[model samples]
Target: MSALYRQARPTTFDEMVGQEHVKEVLLSAIRTGRLAQAYLFSGPRGVGKTSSARLIAQAVNCTAQADKPCGVCAGCRLVREGNHPDVLEIDAASNNSVEDVRELRERILLAPLLGSRKVVILDEAHMMSKSAFNALLKTLEEPPEHVIFIFATTEPERMPPTILSRTQHFRFRRLSEGEIVQKLSRILQTMNREAEPAALQLVARMADGAMRDAESLLDRLLALEVPITLAQAEAALGLPPQEALWGLAEALEQGQIRQALADAQNLYAQGFAARTLAQGLLEAFRAGLYAKMGLGAGPRLESSEEKLVAAMTALDESLERLLKRSDALALELALLAAFQALHGSAASPQAAVPGKPSLPEFNPVRRQPPGAKHPLPEAPPQGTSTPTPTQGPGSRPQMAMDLTQAWRNVLGVLKINQRAFFREAAPHLEGQKLVLVFPEKASFHYQSALKNLEAIQTAVREVMGELEVSLVLQGEKKKVESRSATSLREGSRNGPTPLRGEASAPAAVAGLTSTGSVSASSPPEQSAQSAPPSSPIAEPRVAPLDEPPAIAAKTAESALSSPPLPGDEPPWPDDEIPEESTEAPSSRAQTLVDDPRFQKLLRTFGGRLRKLVQDTPKAPDAEGAAQGDEGSDE
Candidate 1:
């Protein structure tokens, strides 16, 4: 007439399936007569919390023996039949109001009707209202000597602290699968029914550690009135067969995605839901993992632990999706995505075949060894006008090499900014002198190269060994040379160059001459014999050409009176004029001031020529310089 779980409810502490710790403590307290005024039982569902509470009530009122609630005693029978006058069982879930608790408190004060003590059990005690708990708190803390109170709940944390602190707390635990299976077997034996071991195990797993749930599931299977089999159990529960799940897990382990998908689709077609299939496969993989660890019995799979774990992870990720949308196509798509995550998609071209040779992996960047040189571009062929160095007498004899290669090596060794300027120039080595010739229009490049001559010369010496370096315009070399000779002749006839700050008239003095020669205020001497050549002369600083004569004179006078700053060049002598200049103007500072491009820059910018400051070489390590250059280029 009643549910199977109620028919099989535990009647005594010894009859309970698990929670031996709770049973041992309660039994000792009952036998020693050290009973507390109130008791609290807390644990998960269907694991003997209510059963234990009832057992305690019957034990305290039992009259026959100290073994407590002997099944043959009148008090135990009345408690089991739910008609004991002194034992009261209240469902706190439905009667959790303050008025109900006030009535309970008034009833607890009355004497026992049929037994020596009155026991009150409040099941689901955590459902009681806060006010109800407060009303019951004083009585629970100090109750009548002839009465006892019991509170049972699944979540003790929800109960008020005052109520919890006034009771003797006992915690019940969920029974393991083995204990549940054994208990189910005993129950089936009592009913005179037979069940396969696999069927019992499946029922226990589905119960998820709750004895009542397991009993109910077993009772459903027994309604057929036939011996229970694995197939019948699975079909009744709407679960895929264990063999099908194992087959899918095997396919996944062996990287057979097609076969795995086929197996999943077959299960789905057989009326099994997606969530059911996913859960079954997950259990199968978990059993495999356990078997791999030698922990318990499971499907004896050949999959390694890592493969089983990976398969389990895939199943777990797909299980969430199956929960949201449980359909045939969704399950298939989930399986496919999981397969691709583990083993790449079937349509991927990169997958390896069994017999054919696999394609070699190609990396676009080739790593070079440390300190190895990057291969230079090939040298131009002969008669290609690539510059070649000429060995001359009284000069350092160098190895015969391609001048183009030598120039490239020098460019590579220079700093990034210097290389940007010098790369536009074509190199021509004449004897020991290396001339960098720029196009007539590339005056900026030519001027920049001249400013960075020291860095270029240092790099050249590293590559070609101490060659004199010169920069020249491609078509104006001859004109530059002739102009330098004429300037030297006029300078010999005149006196020495004036100081930069002097207020002398614009003149073709020995050193202060520019490209456009201004007329001299002093008449030139008729002496034909030239003065002997002196040491190399410094280049003159000329004023801007567009300025008025008065303003130019004033600027010169101000410059003459101002003190020279640190590192400033000393003024030239007033009487000693050089006669014959050895170095050509194109190779020295004079060439830069005399070039039309340089004059144009001066006129456009409207500024006098300041002192020329050459950069002194700092780093002697050529490799370090090359590395620094490459870093700047990047």
Candidate 2:
């Protein structure tokens, strides 16, 4: 039995699948009797360029009364049988010597015996020697009236420009996956064999748009002589299961580095070609990307658009590094890198605040209010008692007026570098001195300020007009005992017991974790007398370092605090705002606010964006002024 492709070789223009554009032009030319003397067919191998060439030859010499290439006509049959005296098919790859062209030139003088016109088909014509092409150039440029030449090549660029300029070039394109599948279905029907639609689809993809190649593959499968299933197709083609590739893609998307690496190694062990596997992964990822963009349907993998883009990017990079040789380590490393690229975003330093992980753990750090100097207490220990201030007779009183306003002014005037040194100072007026109390945790910040004391004093004097400033680092060990006792009492009287290590310890004992300091030349006794008044606002309260049990575990439970799903109530019921507020505005709306293109538009016409009340109307005089401005610009 001959090969399947040989048996299926198209003899007529209508029998050729795909290349409709090429077929239409050739058929139209033949029907109009305006055929070009020389035709050039170029495209990827097995897309029917050569087959189409043969069909054209048959059509031009057909003896039928209707359409040119009636297969039953003697002229068509003679060409199909390769016994036509007037027509010649040359394999230019082997007969590319000058002697071959010289002989052909001598034979061209003879007239046709069986057909009205002579046709010569040169396959792989680009392989011909330069000398041979030169010899054929004159005959090709001005051939006899009865002669026609058809040159087909996979690489047209290799052909000489002088020769190319004389021929009518027709580009043949690869068939679409759908088109290939349809053709395969028809072929299977001819064989009296059954194939699942999925099996045929797989065969189409494996063909990679080469119609002849697809036929050759189907020929092998038909040899099995069994009802072909998708599994059988995969085995016959030596392709790894789609599930395995999808699983690898899932692992990469989920940031499962180890799993992705293992999958690569496993596929390599299963004997799949590295280049072929990489190519498959690339195609799958490309399809997923298209689906994510709403361009087309793809594999049903439930992943966000961000993840699909990331996976595609990873696969693209990995495919480039993929070597066709035995070592699979390069591909494995690429998989690891891809997973890291997707997963590393969560662990980025920018995602973290002082004492919290990134979302959906919205345990946002307690940010200070716009003008306040201290952080707010975090979920304050219930029922904690405040200590009373002690007054001293000898204590000199600073300006008795509120210092908060003055403190804020000083902070604004301070340079950015200097502000970092003093931002942690919790200040309050006491007698004649302004006491700046540093929490034990901020002892390092206090130390950092020692060198910049003069700068702080100058900034303060400028803002508050010569007030006495005293710096005090809260003593660590002594206060720990007192605060722990207060916390325990509060826990016993009310809410849940505070977790051990819930309170922050002094930096001195915590290994001096941070470096910031302050220095002031005031007697310790004066600082002692300058205790802050019993008010929560008297000092900035520091949040405890230890996290609650709910926060310690990394889980989606913490994300409940984030914006709820559609129709859900706001997670915090006590807050007056409704749980389900309107959805956040689209990104396009936000982008418009700062879009550079919008900036250009603003510059082109002098205009500023502003809000207008519904009830408000422009006054006649204001309208006149606006018109005048427009007139002036014109």
Clash count list over all predictions: 1, 17
Tell me, by TM-score, which candidate is best. Answer: 1
lDDT of 1 by residue, 601-623 (tens): 33322112222211112224434
lDDT of each: 0.71, 0.67
How much is the lDDT of residue 486 in candidate 1?
Answer: 88
In model 2, the Cα lDDT at residue 399 comes to 23
Per-residue lDDT, model 2, residue 398, is 28
Residue 349 Cα positional deviation in candidate 1, in Å, after optimal superposition: 26
| Residue range with the least summed lDDT across 10 consecutive positions in model 2 | 606-615
Best candidate, lDDT: 1
lDDT of 1: 0.71
